[model samples]
Target chain A: MKLKDIIAALDAEVVSAEDLEKEISGGYCGDFLSFVMAQAPAGCAWFTVMSNHNVAAVAALTEVGVTILCEGVEPDEQLKAKAVGRGLDLIVTAKPVFEAVKALDL
Target chain B: MSSLHLEFDVAGNNFVSAGSASDEVKKTLKMLGVDPVAVRKVAIAMYEGEINMVIHAGGGKASVDIDTDKVKIVLADEGPGIPDISLAMKDGYSTAPDAIRDLGFGAGMGLPNMKKYTDEMHIDSTVGVGTTVTMVVNLR
Candidate 1:
């Protein structure tokens, strides 16, 4: 799915507008950064409640299609700046974790 | 064979920049045209060490060397050293506080996962002094 499509599906806010057109293969839901680092696949959308600079760092390493912050989670200005530096796309959502997992797959 | 060497200073308790060094190393490996599979392995192993340095040790030094056939990482820290390397190596062992866990780490997977992804692993630690870990991931 395209990132924009997923954003619309989840009613998410675009935290990183540069990535609206990117392609995503699927989705992964995990709160643990280490677990996601070890297990997240390339080109997948990572759904998390984490709001930190390290999240962007992890997204860059995994090459995830996008990072969706669910449960109204928002990345602070610092992480937003870091995401810009790292070229990581982030989206904010009010949906619960289950909604994203049920609506997306890899 | 030719090689590249890089070093980073990991600040103890600085979670915001925990994996910056590993991220840089990943980019370097990619630019050098290392195999994608090998690069990912090195990234994971090195990133784990970076987190360990921040959470466990006060902060330390990380050195990475990528030669023709392998990537080697050395992490040294002056925090309270591991009293028992054997026990810490256990899959489900962890000493990180609840605060660290709240940030999505402290899962007891740091050293074990690092060892899992590397071709070679070594640890030297003193309870009163500190700890140093060396890991190598081969390209062949």
Candidate 2:
């Protein structure tokens, strides 16, 4: 699935769009940055309620396809700036983590 | 001898910029044509050490030496040193306050993750003094 399709399916709003055309191999949901760093599959969309700046770092370090902030969570200002500055694809959705993952049906 | 050497001052308690050094190192490794898997390993290990410095030590110094075969990361800090290295190595052990945990860290995975991703790990810490962690990830 392409990032744009997943965004449309979840009705997610773009927070910092780096690559909407990137392919999404799958998804990994977690809030713990270290856990995500260790376990998140490369090129998979990361679903989490974590809104802090470290989220961007973890997403970038893990090479995730895109970071999807679920449960209506919004990225903090630092995170927003970092995402844009670092070219990290970040999005937000009203659905919770599980539902957002389900909606993608990946 | 290393082909490249880089250093950074990791700001203490600065969660906003905590992983900047690691990010830079990852970029350097990528640019040097290091294997993606090895780059990811160095990135994860170094980032974990950098985060530990920010959360525990009042910031610290991180230096990286990239060679043809391996990347070595050294994180040194002057903070309340680890009382027990063995215990600190435990996967679920952490002394980080709940506030840090709320920010999505301090789950006690930092050291373990560092050890997990790297080919070599060392800890030199003393109570009431400081701590330094060294890790090396070999390029494949």
Top candidate, metric TM-score: 2
Calculate the i-RMS of every candidate, to one decimal place: 1.5, 0.8
DockQ, cand. 2:
0.83
Q: Can you write out model 2's per-residue Cα lDDT over B16-123, one digit (the tens) per residue?
A: 788889989988888878899999888888989988989888999999999998898999999999999999999889999999999999888989999999999999
Model 2 bad stretches (over 4 Å): none
Q: Please list the C-alpha lDDT of all candidates, in the order they appear.
A: 0.86, 0.90
lDDT of 1 by residue, B1-140 (tens): 58889999999898887888998899899999999888888888888998898998889999999999899999999999999999998876899999888878887878888998899999999998999999999997
Report residue A39 deviation for candidate 2 (angstroms): 0.7
lDDT of 1 at A57: 72
The estimated TM-scores of all candidates read 0.92, 0.96
Error of 1 at B50 (Å): 1.2
C-alpha lDDT of residue A37 in model 2: 81
In candidate 2, the residue pairs with backbone N, CA or C atoms under 3 Å apart (3 or more residues apart, or in different chains) clash, namely B12-B59
**Each candidate's root-mean-square deviation in Å?**
1.7, 1.3
